[model samples]
Target: MNRRLLLLVPLVSALSFAAVTRVEITERGDVLQGAAFGPAGAYERVAGKVYFAVDPKLAPNRIIADIDLAPRNAEGKVEFSADLYMLRPREAAKGNGTALVEISNRGGKGLLGMFDLAAGSSDPRAPADFGDDFLLEQGFTLVWIGWEFDVPPGPRLMHLYAPVATDNGKPITGLVRSEWEGDKRVTTISLGDRNQVAYPLADPNAPENRMYVRDTVAGERRTIARDKWTFSDATHVTMESGFEPGKIYEVVYQAKDPVLAGLGPAAVRDLASYLKFGGAETPLSDEQKTTKRALAFGVSQSGRFLRTFLYDGFNQDEKNRRVFDGVWAHVAGAGRGSFNARFAQPSRDGHPFLNVAYPVDLAPFTDDDGLLKKAAQANVVPKIFYSNGSYEYWGRSASLIHTTQDGKQDAAIARDTRIYFFAGSQHGNGSIPPRSVEAQNQASVNDYRDSMRALLVAMQAWLKDGTEPPTSEYPRIGKDQLVAASALAFPKLADLHLPRIKREAYRLDFSVEPPRVGAAFPTLVPQVDLDGNETSGIKMPEIAVPLASNTGWNLRSKTIGAPDELYSMVGSWIPFPVNRTERENRRDPRMSIEERYKSKRDYLELITAAAQKLVSRGLLLDRDVAKLRDRAAKEWEYALKLN
Candidate 1:
């Protein structure tokens, strides 16, 4: 933690549970409209925006963040505060003591809260959330906080109101870079896509407000005069010649004001602490007050937030107590959030055209190790489960989390940490529909829902009874499973283009007093087999019993940027036709569905056996055996039904 932050922790009054002055947020009782699209059962949904104030003497760290573009809060020691939005079972008895806090993804998305907990909510752009009563079934209280600074304010969108860092009464200014890429001839573009907040140009007409354009991420680059682009609005820049498709554009200019973006991690840490321990004003129920252990799960961007939260020493609260007893970082490869820096954009995912230099994938692959180390703990480090997918190994720098810094060796994961790779799966894909369109670039068959379900059970048991969960299942450098994207080759399917943008990680240095931007380190990716499937990691029955080519890297849609540079997070699923003759005509080096299995019966038999193997190994639960077999049966029915 920074020296300034250290001072606040000591002065903070002991508050365990969060004290909320609840203000109702919705007119209807159900935020997702009735029990039809919301938490099921007799459970009634009552939501309120919870407000709290933090003493600036202790909360001042978030007020003086070392970043450009932060708003001004001149007073050194006033109450720095924020609000939390929540949806819970109106009756306390409906929820178990367990609370699952969700870190909103970019655009104020509660990826896990809506997708997994609620089960049916898929639109990240909007919060028309519905679910299969997953969390309510288990009785886990759902909590969400607005950690990122730039999320636009909207109905049903999660957000935060953090103070900006200022020097005296004047706004601090610094050099900031804004990069973008588009497949269209747009008249203007904001520094951000979802949020319109633009970096104020130091001088709107300054010749130095320069722009550069490139045909490809690495292709030829040429300069465009300042007149070609102008700051049309506070943060939006308009182009005179319009942007070309499959090109990259960037502007480097002076940007003023930086917010104490570090407050994000503080909010997470403190919130968990308050909820678990007890806050002064929080209406802690008799059951809520007795809360013993708190577990946090974040998907993708939020997962990155959890990893960074631990790294920044926020895990230890104001009372020097552990905030979360366990953390599940889902699909958050080897990177930490680009949080808490000058002009920090927590949403940037290191896309080449924009946000190439954000500080990501730093150190600490394990709970007890990395660039940011934890204060010595009384108990053992938090039990962590690093849930990753094909995308992390492909482009998200996930390899850096498991392998040695040099990429030649495997970093010994702590016994407390468990890593699982959803074999033949994409970043966000769980299961595909009965029949997928080949033209849509649908992901391969990998029903990880059962695996995810089983994993959650195992995590709970492990935390409660010290039960040893399934051992780590990931590409191992010691086994020659972790390799470069260029190291593997797949079938020559016409619709699929191999991944060209292998955005690996590096040994980054953001240790400056104010921290620095841009990272260029030596990083590596995992290797795959002849089937284009990862050789190691948890192999779902579908991948182990092959029907389609499934790999982490998938090409971008034609409408997007270069189709060759693997699409963002989504993976590819190219199925083999039922006829061997059809496969032979295409000259596909791989076997067809017919050649792989004699009949639908043969495939079902194989899939059943594969599921059994996983269950015995503890990678899956016995309850999931039926679910896997049923999915296989459905797929077989679909293939044979066509005949």
Candidate 2:
């Protein structure tokens, strides 16, 4: 038998129980033909399924929503399983002691691309998939075990197979709400969020089942005739004339058998605990018996999952040990998501022109009440980095994380936490050769992954050693860098208009259908300079050099149903005219690109200075400066070509 396989023998008695009951290794092989990566040496991929069993009566598992309602095993424990994919050093001792765990975003891996500057791939195997071998070269073991129950099923996609909750051998029923907003008209739509598996309608003709449509996010919901639409099946609704484009549609119906969606967080907590504090039957080689620490990275949906996970108190393991030592939630904004509630839809997220009012964007936004209160109480608060982008400020109420509930002042941040705002960027990385889709302006393309890479290193340093990460960098009301959306003073450049409206967070009461929207928590955006670039936060070379205005908010296109509404998670990039004459002809208020820079070489020089400034502050890596210099040259050409 292989030496590594022999190490799986249990060290404890078989009667003993652990949160991670079994780990089934379905596939194991060398990665990239055993390509060596720095001191970490060759990497190996381990893909499999992990089975979990948690005693519902235990404090850690008891906190899970609907845990008591879930069916129990013969041992009086709830059982679940999840897909697992991990990358580790072939030789156990060669790896970094930290296990970097990425809570899969929508069932696929993202950190490889986010930090390594590589292309997206679900099953990373090829040379390009490793993406410059950034994580491997750092000697960190990469781990991903599915924690979301509703991720769309496909090959290479990670998922959680959680059992449905029941009420004493009978199915539990609750109201499930599904919402959708799209640019193209469609005759049919799934009852799930973003087309994941939907909870089947309990009674198609139930009097409580209702459908509503609205042109804008806050517009009055007009009821659609019950006869106008019908449940095509358990998972879909069919409209005879087709749902209108750019309009919001919602359906609320009775759904039976709520999956113990809360178990998703438990799945993460258990797996991380196993890696850091393993039981008898283990997966690690003898040389790598237990990981010293575990760090978590989650983006967008998964990012919000981390916030919710902390808020819900899943960081404490079954044995009351802390799960993650450090957590980096990127672009999650200030939302906690419907991850652990009754009939929760893990895929639903809040946006300006998309999913409007869900359980997301709730009250107790800042650490004073919601986010870290439970963790602080349990003394399990992990070193946290809440990183957001410009889009999150405008679309996700990200300011709520650091600002007062009223958004009037900056709240004191916890000593263990850091919040960073990526100025003049979007939800994810901006697209290159920026193009407008359904938005009114060209989409933002200011890549901030370079800064994100530096933050990951900073997180590890803070976790492993006592090295303090960079101070929090975000716009503050006290500094006059953050202001009300209505108070924005953007220059009127050619074909560019700041969004008239933005997404706002409200105190929502979900006891009633359609939710009772209470007093709104104030939201603010970063103030802009005379050139229309954001004034505060980490300004990447693109923002600091000023070839164009990159804004967090973009209005919907006129062709769409709501022209004045802010497009969901999209930012605007309006390039300046090439020369003074072109600027004069367009009557643009912003300075011309030629007038701003003496030449392309001068522009590149300024870009370098901007990158170096961030590196000095630990907001950017010195190694990324050269790559930013090369990208600036191409952007310079693209700016001039617009003329």
Candidate 3:
């Protein structure tokens, strides 16, 4: 089957609806400096912010979204808008006709920046601008957009500027609460946490503004006088009393302008449609041959956005055509985006101290069943590839999506969907390389990059070629594989503070639609294996072979936030001894490295077999085998030296 022959014709007729203006900034072989970018002179390093405006009528459901909230845009007309940046091949004939859209994760920091650096390692700083030339090498149209309205502005960050709901153009004021944790006795603080822009009050010192202090989640909410907190600035609230470390302080103040936050979904929908089919209201690429299809990818926060985007039925554009042919959601767990609603906290996530559940990751995963009921929309579901790590099982409700609502029977995944589980890996395991020797207390050295790349190829082949990828690979509830955290028979590691509680999913009460605040319900977590590692999922060599006990849950940084509780999006890496005698001496219930493999060759051989098995099953890619084999050799050397 020829690659070009595999792609289905565009569902909607292509028109010059160029919604974006292109500004070619630089070429790869141009003035970009020292072997600047490893381009073969086929692509241009372009930079431009694509702007878009969505019609409310076109998005009839977005104004209210899934939540049954009163429309904030009193005029019933929303000024919803967002921006995006792109990188593309210079010539139409030089590249594949596929766009890889990335849902920006915390302004694109962490994971990819460290693990997937661009050619020649350009931009060696935070919020890396380039990747391992992986996307470029595939001749893909790489793009990023600002879906989060609350994220602080910075280099290459995407943002959304929306309108607050109005009652006859009158400001809608409500009790909006914000929380923060700090160690130093700071007399001042931002009203919102983590650089989030807070809602402005009609009057700073108004009697309605209030503050409270607490040491724990259950601590009594003691009221602080109006004089203690003053609106030092427009959106910033100040505290006279110093806030102590490891304690949480909250403020509920009057704020105005509740942007129809739900329009967020519409923004993603419109932008994707404009790029894939060309109807943007600006100049665009004449290379229609390479701009005919779309494949969206997101990690962690962005991954959650994909889920929410789908739940809200935003994959279908105004024309009732699919916006994305395929979507790759990584480490999103079983959760959806905290998007769409008045004062929506898109970044709140699932941690206990942070935002509790707010109708996210709800509904069964197998169907367009619960989220959208429209018959036409039901049949328009796109092909999806959801990849998550062990951290999701421990922190994000991973099992709930694939199992019965009560967390018992396994749910049948839709054939269009493939839920992959990367065992013993953290939320976004900081890197994609092999294990290092210098770091003693390091994260799980399980690399998912190569596998992810391989799966991406499989996804494209499936979407364009009418081929079926491998079946879903995740822990199952039917088998003893998926057990509750309470049943984990973990080896006793000295001084390691294990979590008694994990991030739970709740049935929050959104009684008031205008401002969807809520009370909490009971929570659920995934079951684990005897070694404390999640089983029956896609196992990397690190987890399949013996070396250390890697888990997705990590202890909170005691210096800030809720002390001793599970941290956000990070996992723990606990290593083992050389042999069984060493393990028994320390009272470790698990076997040591020596017991698992007799010699260095023995370990390498095991890793080779494991990698081959995963590759055969399509869990691991053949291209990645060499790296795993090399890692095994390195680990064996470390074992020999350490023992």
lDDT of each: 0.63, 0.85, 0.63
- Writing each residue's lDDT as its tens digit, candidate 3 over 130-188 gives 55555555667666666677768666556776666666657777656667665456878
Which prediction has the highest TM-score against the true structure? 2
lDDT of 1 by residue, 1-643 (tens): 9843342232133332332222334422444443432333334433334343444445224332553333323543322344455445555444556666767675354534433534333232123254344555565666666677677666656556667677765877766666676656687877664363554655665544667777665565588876577788768778877876657777666677666777677777667777677655544543355456678888887888888777766677666677788888888877786676777777766643334445666665655455335534434258889988777777677777777766677778776788888877766654545224222376545657667867877887887789999988888867777766566655566655666677645444444311243444445565666666677888888888877777766665667656666555566666666677877787667777888888778888999899999888777778668778788776666544443
Residue pair clashes in candidate 2: none
lDDT of model 2 at position 530: 84
Better of 1 and 3 by TM-score: 1
Better of 1 and 2 by TM-score: 2
lDDT of candidate 1 vs native? 0.63
Question: Which portions of model 3 show Cα errors greater than 4 Å?
Answer: 1-41, 59-81, 109-131, 163-169, 182-185, 218-220, 225-227, 279-284, 357-369, 372-378, 430-442, 512-530, 557-563, 633-643
**Model 2 per-residue lDDT at 81:** 93
lDDT of 2 by residue, 1-643 (tens): 8754653343222212378776677778889989899998998888888888899888888789888888888999899999988888887678878999998987999978998888889889877887778889998989999888888879889999999988888977778888878788899999987858889889887888999998776679999999999999998999998998878899989888888889889989988887777655544443237468999889998999999899889999988888899988889999989889778888888888777889889767777666888888888999999999999999999989988887888898888889999999988788668865778788898999889889888988999898999999999999999999888888876566668888889788998888877878999999998888999998999899978898888888878778888888788888888888988899988888889889899999999999999999998888889999998898888877765
Q: Rank the candidates by TM-score, best first.
A: 2, 1, 3
- List candidate 2 segments past 4 Å from native: 3-17, 280-284, 287-290
Better of 1 and 2 by lDDT: 2
lDDT of 3 at 184: 53
